[model samples]
Target: MKIYILLVITSFTFGFLEKVVSNPSPRPYKAIFNLGDSLSDTGNFLASGAILFPVIGKPPYGQTFFKRATGRCSDGRLMIDFIAEAYELPYLPPYLALTKDKDIQRGVNFAVAGATALDAKFFIEAGLAKYLWTNNSLSIQLGWFKKLKPSLCTTKQDCDSYFKRSLFLVGEIGGNDYNYAAIAGNITQLQATVPPVVEAITAAINELIAEGARELLVPGNFPIGCSALYLTLFRSENKEDYDDSGCLKTFNGFAEYHNKELKLALETLRKKNPHARILYADYYGAAKRFFHAPGHHGFTNGALRACCGGGGPYNFNISARCGHTGSKACADPSTYANWDGIHLTEAAYRYIAKGLIYGPFSYPPLKISPNKIA
Candidate 1:
C-alpha cells in the first residue's frame, strides 16, 4: 500500500511540474512605442531646431546629461526611456528621424515635444511665438508611420505583421490642448474641447489597431494647476482649500474626472476590439505621489522651481530662459519634483515610471500566477 501511494504522489508531482514548465507567464514587453510631448521628447526638439540656438539647448541645461544639451526637457532621461530600459529594450528613436541604419525592430517615438491633440492653430501661434516645432498632430503622425513602413518592409502585409508584433504608446499629447484652452480662457468651453480631444485620441488608437497593434498603452493628463508656474500666475483665492502639499484639490478633482472618463472610453474600445489589449498609464496618480513624497524620491527643497532658470517667483522667465548666464540654478535637481513649472525632473520621472511599471496601472490587482501566455 505504501509503495502504491508513493508512486501516485510522484506521478502528480511530475504532472504539476510538466504543466508549470510547459506554460509560463508571458514575459514583459520586449519593445516600447512612445507618443506624447516634452515629457518624452528625447532629442527631437533639439535635432529639429525647435529648441533653437540660445535656449535650453546650451550649457547648464545639459550640464548633467552627456555634459551637453541632448534636447530632453529635463536634467536627464525621460519617463519613456526608463520604461524602455525597464523592459530591457534600447532607447526609443524618434519616428520623424528613422534612418535605414537604425534598428527600429524595437519601437519608435511619435511624440513631438510640442505636439497637441487638437488643431494646430493654437500650437502654431505658440510655436510662432517661441519658434518651437509646429504641432505634429496624432492624425498626421499615424499617416507618417504608414508612409514610412512601405520603405522598410517588402510588402504591405509584411508591414502589418511588424505592427502586429509591436507595442503602441498613444499619449501625453492632450495637455497642450488644455494649456491652450486655459490660456485662451476657454475652460467653460470644455463641452467643445474635451470631446474632440478624446475623439482624436480614439481615432489615433483605432488607426493603430487597424495597423495591427495588439498591445497598447495610453497615458492620461497630470495636474497642471498644481504646478508652481501655473499657480504663481493663476492662484485662486481659495488657496486655503489646497492640501498641505500645495496641490489644489479642485484641480486634482478635475484630473480625476478626466481620467475616469478616459478609463471608461478605453474599456469600451477594448470591448469593441476584443483582440486588442489596451491599458491606461496613470500619469495623474504617479505624479501625485511624487508631489506628496518629494523627499522619498530625491528632491529636498524648491519642489516647484525649475532647475535651470532665472527668476524669483517661479524660477522661470519667458525671456531669461533656461541655460542662460543670469539664470538661477537649483542646488540639486534630483531632489525637486518639478523641473520646469510644467514638467518633472529626471528623478521624478524615474519614480513615476517605476510606479507605473510595478504598480496597479501596468498590471492591476497584482495577478498572482496569472496565465498571460496561452
Candidate 2:
C-alpha cells in the first residue's frame, strides 16, 4: 500500500511539473518606472500631500479594486497598474511613499494627481496660477526619479544594467496643461500651449534616454473632447462643433494635434537613438474606441457620461465633484467608461490597456517577449 501511494504521488508531481514546463510563464519586467499625471498616478498625490484634490483620496475612488481610495483618480486601478500586472510585477509604490529602507528593486511610480507637462511657473508667469492645482509637473516627477537613481544603482555600469531590464512609462501627460488653459476660456492660450507642452514631453523623454533607459512607452493625451469635464465646460449650441459621438470636435482636434506633434518628436528621438526602443502608446485611440462603439465595447452606460459625479447632462458638476458631498458613484462602474468627470473607470482602463498590449491601439504594438518587452 505504501509503495502504491508513493508511485501515485510521484506521478501526480511529475504531471504538474510537465504542465508547468509546457506552459511557460510570460516574460516579466525587472521593474517599472512611471511618470505622468492623475491618469497614471498610483498614489504620489496622496503621499506628497500636493494640492488637496480631496476627491481622489476619499471613498468610492478605488472602490472597484482596492476597495478604498488609494490616491488614484479612478474608481479602480489605472492602465499602469494593469500593465504592471501583465508583466507579473507588483503594483508600483508611489515615489513619495518610499523611504530609505524600502526596497527599490520592484518598481516606483512618479506620477502625481493634477500633474502637468508644463512647469507650474509657466502658468504662473502667464497669469494663470488659479487654473493650476499642483506644482508636481513632469520636470518635478523626473527630478524625483533622478534623486532616487543613486539608490537604485551607484555605478554607471550597474545603472545601465539595472535600467535596461526596467520599463519606463513617460506619459499620458500634458493634458492638464491644456485642461487649465481651456478652463480659463482662452482658445488662443490653449492653442499656444500645445507646441511647448509637446516639446517639454519630448525633452523629458530625451532626458530619460540619456539616463540609461533603453525601453520607454510614451503615451499621448486622451480625448479631452469626450471627457465629462470638457463636455460640461465646452458645451456648444452649434451642431457642427459636436461630433456624431457627441464629443466636442474642436477639443478632440486639439488633442489629436498634440498627439501628432508628439509622434513626430518621437520619430526624431528614434532616429537619434538607434539603440533604444521608444514606442508611442496611443491612449487617445485606445480610449476613443469605447466612444465610437459603446455597446460593442460593453460600455452600456455610454462613453461620455461619468459613472461617478454630481448630476448633469454628463453627470459631472464642477461644484460637486466625485467624492465630495452631493456626489455619488454608480452601482456598476464596469458599464461606464468615464469614472469621475476627468479620469476613466478601472474597467475602461483595462480595455484600453488590453488594446495597447494586444492590438490596434499602439503603434508597433506592445509585445511581451520571452524575457522582456519586445
Candidate 3:
C-alpha cells in the first residue's frame, strides 16, 4: 500500500448556526439501526473479511481513535457513532457481529462497506465473502428483523416492544450506485438508476415501519463531485463551474437531483405510513459547508487533494491502497475535508453528525408541531 501525502486548503465561510429550541417532550430513541457504506461501516469490513488488518486496523488509522481501530473506517469514530453517543445509546453493533448477549440489548448495524442501493457488482468486489447476513441485497436486511427478533428477545411480545423503541437509519447506501454510474461514464444512467435506488430505500423503510421503527432517520447522498478524488479525476476546463475551492458544480448538481428525488420518495412513504416518524438527513449541505469553509471548522485546505488516493482521474488509482508507498496521505487529515477521495475525515463526520443532531434537517420547525407532542 503506497501512501501519497497532500495538503488540501479551502477558503470559504464556515460554522453552523446555533439556536436553542425548546426540547420536545422527551421524545428520545432507544437505539439506532444504521445502514450504508464505508461512511457508516464501524467494523463490518474487518468482520466480513472485506479488508485485512494493518490498513484501517493499524496504528495511524486509529492513532487518534480509542487506542484501537475498533472497526471504524476512519482515524476515529464515524458519524453514526457520534449520533449514537449524542442520543446516549451504546454504539450500534455490526449486524454481522451480533452475539447472543449483544443481540438483545443494543441496536444492530446492517451497514456494510461498499453497500449500494441497487444489487450492483461493486459490493461483491468490496469483499462480502458470505451473503450470510442476507441475500446480498438491501431488501434482505429488512427480512432479518423477523429472523433475529425471536432469538434476541425473551418473547415475541418483547421483541415487538423492542422494535417500537428502535431508530432506523437507511442511508450511506446509495453512493456506490452513483459511483458505479460515474466510473462507467454514464451519468445519464442515474435517470434510470435513481428510481430503483430510491424504491429499494423506501421498501427498506416500509419494512422497518411494519416491524416497529417509529423514529427513522434517512440520510441522502453526499456531493460526489466535490470529492478530491472526483475533482482530480474529472477536472473540467470551465473553472467557473468549479468554485475557487475546486468543487465541481456539475457533479454536485447530480447529487442535488438525487437528493430531491429521495426527498420526494420519502414524502410519499410518509403518506403511506403516517405513524412512522421519518427525517431526512442532509449530508450534502453539511459536506458543502466543510469543503467551502475549512478554517472555521478547523480544516485548512479545502481542495488540495485527498490524503489517501492513488492514480486516477481523481488520483484514485485502484491498484494502490492508502498508506502505501507512492500513495498519498494528507498532512493532518483533520485539516482536509476528505480523508480519502471518497470518504470524509473523522472530524468531518463529527461536524456532520453535529449538524444532524441540531440542524434544520433533523429538527425542522414546521415538522415539529406542538400538537404532536401534546
Candidate 4:
C-alpha cells in the first residue's frame, strides 16, 4: 500500500507585466486559468459558506494580509494571487464569483479548498464517505472551466488567441484524495488509488491542451512527512518510521512516489504534445529547504510547530480548527512556517514562491522566453 497522500503548494512563474521579477522577461500571459485545491483557491470554499465544515472565511486566515478570512487557507495571498501580482494583475477572481467579465482578462481561479483530483465517490469507496466533499473534485472544477470557456471567446480565432496566450495552473491536486484515505485508516488502499488519480490529472491536461492551452505549470504535492497536519494525524513513536528530521519516513516516501509518477506523466505528455509547454514545479523541494533550514527564511520555530492552534507538538488539532474563537494568532507569523496545521503562512508561501520563480524547480526556465511585454 502507498500509505500516504499528496499536498497543495505555493509557486510563481517568472514573466511579464509593468514589472519583471527576473531577468529580461518573457511576455506575461494575459490570462491565468487555475485548477486545483485550497492551495490555489482564492475564495471558493468560504464563498460557498461551508464555515462549520471546511471552516474558513473568518479571522486568523487573513490575519496576515487581507485582515479577514478571504476564504484562502493561508493567512494571506495564495501563490496564485502572487502570480497575478507579479505581472501587475489584480488577485485572480474565483469562478464562483462570476458576475460579469469584470476580471476575466486576468484569468479565473476554479480551485476550491478540499478539492480532490478524483471524484468524491472515490473517497467513499476508499472508506472515507464521511469526509467526501462533492463539489470540490477536479471533475467539478473542470466543469466550471468548460463553462467559463464559452465566455472567454466567441469565434474560433479568438479562442485560439486567448488560450494560446493564457497560462494554465493545473494542480497540486490528488492530495485530498489520498488525505482522506490515510486519515480514514485505509492506507492499504493508497497504492491502488495512485494510478487512477494520475490518470485523471493526465486526462485533465489533455482536455486543457485540446482547448488551446499551450503553457501549463503544475506544482506537485508538499512534503507530507513534514506537514504538521500529517505528523499530528499520523503520530508515531516508532523511531524506525521517523526520519532524523522527525518526519515520518514512510509518509514522505509515499509523497515522493506520487511526485516521481507525476513527473513521468508530464514527460510523456510533453512528448505527445511537443508544441505545448508543461512544466513541473517541485513543491516538495521548495518546502524542504524551509524545513531543513527554517532560520534562513526567518522561520525560527522550525517545522515541528505551527504558528497557531493547540494540541500536540505540532500545535494542531483536528477538532479545534483554525479561525475559531480562542484560537490565537502567533505573535509573529513570519517566525513560523506553518500557519495552522494544514496550510502554510503567507510568509512561507512567499518564500516558497520566490524559490520556485528564481530557482530551477520551475522547468523550461521561467525567465528565458519573452513573447512580448504585456
Sorted on lDDT, best first, the list reads 2, 4, 1, 3
Off by over 4 Å in 4: 1-26, 51-54, 367-374
List the candidates' TM-scores in order. Answer: 0.82, 0.91, 0.80, 0.89
Overall local distance difference test of candidate 1: 0.69
Q: Rank the candidates by TM-score, best first.
A: 2, 4, 1, 3
- Residue 51 in model 4: shift from native, Å? 5.1
The TM-score obtained by model 3 is 0.80
How many steric overlaps are in each model, in order? 4, 0, 24, 2
Q: How well does candidate 1 match the true structure in TM-score terms?
A: 0.82
Give lDDT for model 2: 0.87
Best by lDDT: 2
Q: Residue-wise lDDT of candidate 4 within 212-330, one digit each (tens)?
A: 89989988888889888889888888889887777888888988999989999999999999989999988998888888888887888777688888657888887666766546668
Q: Which has the better lDDT: candidate 2, or candidate 3?
A: 2
**For each candidate, what is the lDDT?**
0.69, 0.87, 0.68, 0.80
Query: How big is the positional error of residue 170 in model 4, measured in Å on the Cα after superposition?
Result: 0.6
lDDT of 2 by residue, 107-169 (tens): 899998888999999999988898776899999999999998988899999999888889899
Off-target runs (Cα >4 Å) in candidate 2 are 1-28, 369-374
Best by TM-score: 2
Model 1 stretches astray by more than 4 angstroms: 1-27, 51-54, 121-133, 151-161, 363-374
| Superposition error at 293 for model 1 (Å) | 2.6
Task: Give per-residue CA lDDT, model 3, range 1-374, as digits (tens).
Answer: 12222222111111111222333344366667777777887776667775433466554465455767666667777888887777667788887777767744667777776666766453355343233222235665555555766665666577567767777788867777777566656666666777888888988888878766777888888887787656766777886888655678888888898899989988988888888778889888887786777788787765345656675545555556565556766557777666667677777888887777766556331122222100
